[model samples]
Target: MPDRDVRPVRVRLLEAAARLLADEGPRALTTRRLASEVGASTMVVYHHFGGMPELVRAVIVEGFARLAEHMAAVPRTADPVADLGRLALAYRANARANPHLYAVMFGGVPLDGQAPPAEEPVAGRAASGAGTFGVETFAAETFGVLVEAAARAMDAGRLRRDDPEHVSAQLWSAVHGFVMLELAGQFTGGAETVLTSMLVNLGVGLGDAPDAAARSLRAALDTPAP
Candidate 1:
């Protein structure tokens, strides 16, 4: 028998497919191509994810799962607004770390049946059923993490009294927009400073007093990302 490769086949194959899709479009996701990228056999791809369709679905789900894991890992601090800030930072970091997967998760490459319109969705990958702006936030599972964080802030009288889902959508839009810009190499300033400013502005917009919002976001910026 040929010497078996011992690397994590599923992860390697999935990541390779995402990169192919992101870099070269969907047509690049051939079985042979994926195998060559991972230095594995086509058999490994079929065995691990069944077929291309299955692999595509797995890619979308895995993207959201990885994002959820990142959000979930953020330790909830006493300051809910600060916690929201941390989650926002985590969202950006996850996107930066997994640009290809992030593209697949968002509207960049439509693995799902939904066609991308002229303007791409900033709040993609929302798993939960978004109440008002249902289209934004593609993965609700991951967005739910954001909602919970924002709700904590709202409950603590940090944000305005309103729907957490809606609040999360607004916040997600800002964070996602920044990530998209950053990934596109359009950003030229300090990341933390930019993010902190955006969050502080959003905080005030969401009903936090200007001073309090600035203070909370300052704490958020000072705290380390998870």
Candidate 2:
């Protein structure tokens, strides 16, 4: 397949770019440095991605793509609420697995020395107009997994009848904030405890019966994180 020729080099370049951004910040992301980091010629980056801006965009999108894979791997159970809880764990696991990519995927990776606007919209609300690099496609798709899971829970009466998208956004916000804090070392050894409680509280807030929600979340957490 044609992708066979493209995927390896592209992935290497993307990974190298993410590491450079993580280790040295945005200003350190030069073509020569990236090429040297991967022991490839600078032309490889340009050939694979065309230019720096495009490569950065690819890295962010790839981050989302990897996240989607992680969530998608979560096996669906009979209990939708439990599935949602497991998905939250999967989301955190992905972030912990690649903190560098998470930083680059979300905010915190300043773009070429440009400061983010004071009041940028959230990525879920307005990907392009959010005064940030646009990775709308993968971002939307990744968030869509949660939307579908939320809809399933709502349909099963595990949650109240509200907009699934809205509920998904709230859950995403909670997980995203927790992941960011954890990456920044804000959480102590109690990350697992805090996240479990937060998931249970989120479930209760969505109108689930407290006992059922806590039970489901605890059961889900007992399994290996997807």
Candidate 3:
């Protein structure tokens, strides 16, 4: 071999931690266990993350970054409502894809009322007139994307004219609730269908353009005489 890559080792460690967090829960995370899981020595884990708290934060940040990437990947269509729907579906899919990482990114670990380890400062404007993370906290990065999309929808006249900030927050809250409950197995109905219906109704209230695109797609499918 042309020499093994060290970077992949660190990445594997982080990926292991994220999976452990989602599958077993935060309490189960430990450097020793992580090292064993990744087939690396305990010293390697320390070298990569310094300590447990820092490692926790890195994993959480990675989780959020992945979410932001997914949100960014949602296709941009001229129709803002359709775009938002795509974004919403993407959000749920990510959570389902990485449940533990999602939990850690959201303060899933019981830290005795302390905040989960934050790897970096939230990047945005703070309410105190100081600039902060605004909504750029790695954990909630997806929420930021949703807020921005909501505002774009309003600006494009696809959604109703409302407070973008308020509507964005509300929309995020609803979607998060659905994901959380579904993860907890609280929803007996399939989460996929439920979430789609939820977003459709939410679009109606939030100002999705008339169902023209959906109608057109359906019509195209219905036309059979090739």
Most lDDT-accurate candidate? 2
User: Of the candidates numbered 1 and 2, which has the greater lDDT value?
Assistant: 2
Q: List the candidate 3 regions with Cα displacement exceeding 4 Å.
A: 1-7, 23-27, 112-141, 207-226
The local distance difference test score of each candidate is: 0.77, 0.82, 0.67
TM-score sort, best first: 2, 1, 3
Residue-level lDDT of model 1, residues 1-226, one tens digit each, is 9877675778777788889889988777889999999887899888876777667766766677778778888888888888888888888878888999999878678554323233235465322221222223336667888889888888899888899999999999999998998898887769767877888989988989889888777787786665
RMSD of 1: 7.1
Report the lDDT tens digits of candidate 2 across residue range 107-161.
7787765332332344543222223334666678789889998999999999999
Off by over 4 Å in 1: 1-7, 110-138
By lDDT rank, best first, the candidates go 2, 1, 3
- The better-scoring model by lDDT among 1 and 3 is 1
TM-score of each: 0.83, 0.85, 0.75
Which candidate achieves the best TM-score against the true structure? 2
